[model samples]
Target: MKTLALLSAAALTTTLLATPAHAAVTQWGACLPGQGVDPRQECTTIEVPMDYSAPGGPSVTLAVSRIKTARPEVRRGVLLIIPGGPGSPGLNRPSTLVKKLPQEVLDRYDIIGFDPRGVGKSSPVSCGLAPADLSLTRLKPYPDADGGIAENAAWSRRIAEACARNGGPLIRHISTRNHARDIDRIRAALGEEKISYWGVSYGTYAGAVHATMFPATTDRVVLDSNDDPDPRKVSRQWLANYAVGVEDSFPDFGVWAAARDSDYGLGADAAAVRKTFLDLAARLDREPLAWPGAKPEQLLTGNLLRETLLNALYSTANYPMLAGLMKAALNRAELPMPNQPEEAALQNTAAHAGATMCNDIEWPNSIARHEQQVKRNRAVYPLTAGMPVNLGPCAYWPFKPAEQATRISSRGPANVLLIQNLRDPSTPYSGALKMREAFGQRARMVAVDSGGHGVYLANGNACGDRTVTDFLVTGHLPARDRNC
Candidate 1:
């Protein structure tokens, strides 16, 4: 799958009809059959076109799941949870959130989740990449020692070519605009006149597009960990911003590493911890160490160290894992083993993620341009090295985008709510502000003074969680932006 967590992972309208094109009667059935479906959860599938331009052509089924409110008398339609990771699984999201959300959220609406096209259980696509190529270091364009990008460029071409060869026609259709259109279809399938949405990370962009494209049918929209909808630069902007985001978040990691009283013994303080990390990374660059159980060869290089840091930075809960890895590396002992994703599942994720990113917009094809950008970014943002601006499969994407990217605007209804963490690494507060500005008067933001990516229910901030829950349940908005 994609290494970038951000690329990691809406709507109802009822008018009148019971035909094939109309809303299909959702025959709720057993969910997650082999994966232990909850008694309260029900599952079903809906058919959508491989290409919307030819709606009558080939179609793909999207898996959907729902947990209806226990109190039907006060039920307020459906609340769709939009997942992050353009490739992250979502059919089980309702199951995951059911335990985390307050009863108020679970009681007010039927919680819904689904796997998008080209993802799990939804007519999946796969590039069939070799296990070595699928590793995090190779997935992201981390340059080789001496700052050479020859291997990165070759890998980028290989990935792009593999997707083109194996991903089929559906690959080109996997994009944000089409994703928004699919949401309307899902809305119809649910037979709801209007639906509320709770979207985080990349889902925020999808939810925003759905609201923009079908404002009249949107209700109580919540966009958390926003993305910059710069029409010209969609995922490209997100990829580039990781340099800044990583630098912004590394201090938190440093503080945590310094405070630990365990075997990591990274440093006595934040500054020293950062220095230790830098020294370790430089040493790894010079002499890559073996890490048994790691795919291909178990080599721990500088790139892997940086990737581990980025992965661990997503949540405070993951700090210890990185520390453990650091300790193992420091002692030159066996490193902590990682749970490798199933080969087939990983292929599907990579195909979906790479196809969607490339199909969304054309990326710069000039390796020279990327080389310059990477060099400049590396100098300015040493925490991320040059990976943020380095070449990836997008640079050699086989197909041009199917359509122009959607331009987000404030022309939609004033039903949007933006929730953001001030120091998010993936979707930084700076980018969230751009999304907020794009919505203009259409949205009121709830800024949480947090360090992680997601906010609202997941951030453990009561003020933010209450603001979103109350809005969904009672259709109220703050007069202005509120900071928690």
Candidate 2:
């Protein structure tokens, strides 16, 4: 993790070319076709050079959108909604999430969203991976049968080779540092002196980079479900944290599974429910049940249940799906696989996710070390079945980290406020604490007594939402650390 800190510092000092100032404010009248957004929401295209340092080089067009502030008297500046996925397109978010914001917040800002480089309507990149390689179950980090990531290592190598052959030079520029510069370009295009933002999941990493690179231009930045910026470990650190996340969040699923025993016929007690899940996963490891429509020819029950459980942890609303899947498996009934979106859509999204994660940081190239860790992780965190700590495309990523990972410093303004859930399955509390410690007293943290990801307005308690909303609306934070 400390390795990441050094990398981030180095990245900050690296020279980035500046864009020429343009006075033209070209506003387009039409909305993006088929977005179903309100007519008042404006859509347009902004051309950015593919390589920022080479201003005369080939360029890419980033799609941008904004819903203007309804109240002119109280208008402040632009509120940028940075999307996650290293590959997620935020092009339509302003018309969606921004509309739900409190009027006071809306009045003070013009909500904006853009497709990050190599994603959505922005200039895209693809590895041209076969359909079999695009499965969610396959894309997820999972260890080999012998509790090793040798296969993952090979997969990573294959992906890197494919991307190199097909991704062109644009793949090299997808790093978060470059994305921060892209945001700055968007800010310049919008003609705003400074920008406020709400960044979720991987988007938080982008926001942090933006703030670090251009601290003076940031205002009211909200980083939700934050990622640890340790450049050495990077996404690997995130995958390993899932073990802690499952430990933190699985208990909630256990309680839910036990309470619904009468309906699901899974178990009469929470302990029994927990044991049943583990037992079933172990059993499936030996004799997997057949599942139609799933990738890899047939779905192993353990991996299927693991996939279901991970998706379920995203929100409480998906609990019943997990419960139903458990019931079907318990009854030895035929289980159906969930429908995947169109092939083109899946390929596009997977390519973007791969590019973003692989480009952000360099991964360890040691297969033996990954195998040792996965074995130890599976033995201790059986509920997660060692999938959380497994390797992905980064292990064999062709490029070294563009810059070392960013070491977060509390040297800036104390205006930053953190809102976290006690048991976030994706970004667990333990990881959040690291981020909190990194920020130090430069920021205040409000820990909500809740579960799931995205603390505010997504899966958080009222106390948590009020803390964040109050900060956003009034620019005041609690004088000290507070727990809800």
Candidate 3:
């Protein structure tokens, strides 16, 4: 869900184990059958006040899960796996994480994961968006062929209104601050005075806020694929960074395609590959292919090609998918089917993201302002083509932020470790630096010479993996910021 494209079917763009004492004690049970669930994961629920300010008000249940360390005697504490996406489903993260985590790290901590209040297995929210509004193009909408966003503006209003109409009180309550509070609640439920954390993407912001708000209750922290924690911009900054991120990451694809020109006739070199992609996108914009659910009238246009290009830069593994699709499009041959995720899941995540992003900070409500920004952005960054600043649901959200955005500070334990890829397509390195700056002396950064949305164990950066693992195993941080 890092790229809004990943879960933006229709443009909606889309745990832990712990046993503790008193209020934190959980009753674990078998998970209801679901995809990708690890059998070893035990599940349960925690009832939290829907509105933390009103503790006695109605409550919502969050599905929580955990995988206890078999080597309990050596267990140090609970390790919460904070997931990315304001809409990202995380109940199964513990299961997925167990496979990737080093044995020593697993032995030292009971891995925990949870579906935030409005995600899978937890209470979910949906805007009941019409099928038309749910198309993949809507997630990161492009301006009209002539650089207009009248339709994009319409989609924003429709989505924002739909969310307010269909979303219940819980949607209004799902803010990053609230998510941070929920994390604290989980910590209390686990009966831990301080919890260790490994947060990724948007999770890094939540974790940063958690460490900021409840610094006394946090132990070792690993923030991977960080977000800019500027209280003023918040999610708006995240949205804008997509343009910069794409610019930074697309070169990797260009070079890769150029090198493998024999397999895929994109171009013979980096410059040639870049020109080929730009030309193909422009050509498609002028002469679209038939696609059932693409935006700007059910046809594959240049914008969709650009969107696909942005999504493809997310991982090297996805390079072939984009390369092949481009080849097919260029040849006017059989194109691969657009990969559509389950619709209901898309709605849930879209609504979840809508609530969290809009509720995190106050967005400029003027559609004109958004259009103006988009126009300026489009001129400077052609790769993203103004999608970054395009009118989105946040511009018309139903409620104002319940509270101010959390400002991460240097006033915490020196336990936060940041690992970032210099060319992450989703969360750019420049934004990660802002996150590091926000944390100040409280965090140490390991700038890996790699590319992609995630780093540490994920990017196969041995130095990064070891640095993070060593920190988790023994509360030791590097004396100074280092490059891997």
The top-ranked prediction according to lDDT is 3
**Residue 336 lDDT in model 1?**
81
Q: TM-score each candidate.
A: 0.94, 0.91, 0.94
lDDT (CA) for every model shown?
Answer: 0.81, 0.73, 0.84
Please state the error at residue 281 of candidate 2 in Å.
1.8
Question: Which TM-score value belongs to model 2?
Answer: 0.91
Q: Residue-wise lDDT of candidate 1 within 1-484, one digit each (tens)?
A: 2222223321111121122434484488887454545677888888877787876677777788999899898898999988776777688788778887888878888999998887887777788787888787786778886677889999999999998887777778899888888788888889888989899888999999899889889988999999888889898988877787777788888888887846589998888888888888888999999887777547889888888888777788878888888888888988888745666666777888788789889998888988888888878877678988888999899898878888788997788999998777788888889999999999999998877778876653999989988898888999899999
Q: What lDDT tens digits, residue by residue, belong to model 2 across residues 19-122?
A: 44342358766665555576677887677777666767666767788888888788878889988765666777877866567777888888887878777667
Candidate 2, residue 113: Cα displacement in angstroms equals 1.3
In model 1, which regions exceed 4 Å deviation?
Answer: 1-23, 34-36, 261-263
Residue-level lDDT tens digits of model 3 in 401-422: 8898988999978999999999
> Model 1: which ten-residue window has the lowest total lDDT?
9-18
The all-Cα superposition gives candidate 3 an RMSD in Å to the true structure of: 3.5
50: Cα error in model 3, Å: 0.5
lDDT-best of 1 and 3: 3
